[model samples]
Target chain A: MTAAQPATGHDHVVVAADVNGVSVTEPVPTRWTLAQFLRDRLGLTGTKVSCELQVCGACSVLVDGAPVSACTYLAADIDGRRVQTVEGLAARDQLHPLQRSFVEHFALQCGFCTPGFLMMAKALLDRNPDPTEDEVKEYLDGNICRCTGYEPIVAAVLDAAKRMRGQA
Target chain B: MVLPPFALHRPTTTAQALSLLAEDSVPYSGGTELLLAMRMGLIRPTALVDLKRIPEMQEIRTDRSRLLIGAGVSHDRLATDPLVEQHARLLAAAEREVGNARVRAQGSIGGNICFGEPRSDVATVLIALEAELGLANSAGERSVPAEEFFLGPYWTARDATELLTAISIPLPCAEGVYLKFQTVERPTVAVAAVRRPGGDYRVVVGAVGEVPVWADYPGVGEVDPVDLVGRTSPVSDLTGSERYKRHVTEVYIRRAAELLAESER
Candidate 1:
């Protein structure tokens, strides 16, 4: 098969991501990252992209319901896979417990890193609801929060876990 | 920034990928390392042949005596694999410590080994385990031991026409442990040591040299620190001075000895 030239037109790469309980297939660019496809192609820009490199975690999205760096993953790789971005986290008029806890605990100083932190925290708590302080730190080590110290962020995650489990 | 303009080729067979590579097109697996290199202008290829679609290149099965790991298996998969965890615990642990969860999920073992990055944590572990690399081309298939696969800093013994298909790690008679000493938030200096039954050992030190260095331990006698030190000529990079790396290598060797001693007990 002869290789073709790079074109700007949109080619159909089947992406079976669940966007807020809706399974959709879209035609995306061959080189489009999951972050770009979410924001530019699907117009779901709630998942922010700060450092395109995987360092800053600002573009964290749930691939198969696990928090992953969307900026680094190619959209084509997740073909026929389910993806859930921040926009898909909450129900229609009902906020997820982590979202509510972030607002209640003032976990955001600038709100730029909130989505990433929330996604990471959500994934952590989903897997381990009653995580220790050290476990929480280790699990969220990949996330970088430049706005506020991690004290409130950690507290909010813990508090959210308690709230979700009806503990306190 | 957008990825530079390049044609993408999804090759369904290893032969197809090797043919493209023979024509100077780059074969891509994870795209984590190659993408970074392309962005830095270190590698400027006009085409990228994606190898993820190849069925034979994604198998992680085991033979009678060896564990055959496909090149496309991600670090995340390796870390959580039952067979890999049972046979190569140190490798599974090191894979967990690779970059982060994201990189672990996206990066492949083949890409990690084939890239031949000097500072790679998995490369050192593979060398310590005495893994065999399987390479294929239009000519035929060849298996190169991991120790000889890495030639120098970011250099491998791979020919232009070859595509690394799988990595085979021989089941060892010992419990292995990998110890890495990294300065705070960077790559590690020394990586793994395989301590077998009857007190035989193979200590692998990476990031301190151009390629991972393997030293044989005769027996569990009084280990001379000097013997382990200065074995590898480390460079003074931004990570640390050559002197500091040598010192850390000794420290990790002692640490490995203690761990092995406890495991034996």
Candidate 2:
């Protein structure tokens, strides 16, 4: 499954994106962005679309194990790339530690920006298990949260780190 | 919103990608820049050849002599990779400053370099690092040094049928720093400055011109502002005027010199 045969014809592009752990291949318009493809073609709405421009970070999703905004990224460009949205953060009935911490710490108000924040925080903590306040702040700088300010989100991330380390 | 209708092709190999591109198909990677341009209707290609699946273009390997970064390696990976930090820490720092977490995840180094936008932070760092870009076409493979890579704004030496394979960066002497000044907080202005041992310096300024400008100033004897500014062509964009950019470059150069001097001391 590493190399997919190039299908004949160019009318529809075959997208072999591994969303979370699920390998999905679908025919998408050549112009469809990954965000639109996820929301419309694959019916994965967990990856939201807010700022189509690369700014707001509301459309954040993990592409190939790294957080990226899906709005401006084309589905045709992500062939064979692994993508993970907010929907893939949980396992069965148990939410990821970051997700649980967000709820426990009340990190979300309207929750419009929660997914982006969660993804960004997950990216940060995954790379640096014990991130200092400055590191966390620097890492989360791109993810804009208009609600609940930033203290609760930072607290949620810290708490999640503690729980992950068996400290909480 | 949805993308306009167009043809798509996924090329598994670089040769196939080049062939498709030779047939006038637009090669796409990561699509952070291409998609935006498509949305803006700046480019309207009938077919898009996706290069993500090409195995040769996704590797990041470093030897004792040089680091070969695949064109498709994402900014996020570059920013966090231990190897990248060890070899090109300044580049890693600049990678961290690219966009948001999302942009870094989706944006590829090849795409960034080929996009030819003068405001690119990575381009500045690559120029300062004296990176060499590897390009492959149906004909053969050729390497272009970073100093000679960019032709103009949003343009490179790459032909329509050529695919950028890799970028090779020589290992520095464990002494380098990249400092950037952004207009507000979104897009950065001046990008990176690398300081090597023995007072060797490379200063790069981005976003202030049509293409990133590199100046190698080793010591105080070679610090000529007139000669340095004359070599670079700065453009007036929404971010800053040409004069303003030049002024900032001077300020950044002086600041970088001081930082490098302190590091030496």
RMSD to the true structure for each prediction, in A, is 3.7, 3.3
- B145-257 in candidate 2: lDDT tens per residue? 98888888888999888889999988753256677677444354564666654557666667666777766775634655556666677777776787887787777666765
Clashing pairs in 2: A68-B102, A69-B102
- Local distance difference test, candidate 1: 0.77
lDDT of 2 by residue, A1-168 (tens): 443645534666677878889988787766677888888878888777786777777788876667777788777656777888899999989999999999988888989888888888888887788888888887788777877469988989988988887843
TM-scores of chain A in all candidate models: 0.88, 0.91
What are the lDDT figures for the candidates, one per model?
A: 0.77, 0.77
lDDT for each residue of candidate 1 in B151-257, tens digit (9 for 90 to 100): 99878999766889999988653456777876533365865767754567777778788887777777544444467666787888887888887887788878876
Highest-TM-score candidate = 1
> What TM-score, computed on C-alpha atoms, does each candidate reach?
0.90, 0.86
Root mean square deviation (Cα) for candidate 1? 3.7
lDDT of 1 by residue, A22-98 (tens): 77666666667787888888898988887776777788887776667877777765665677778877888898888
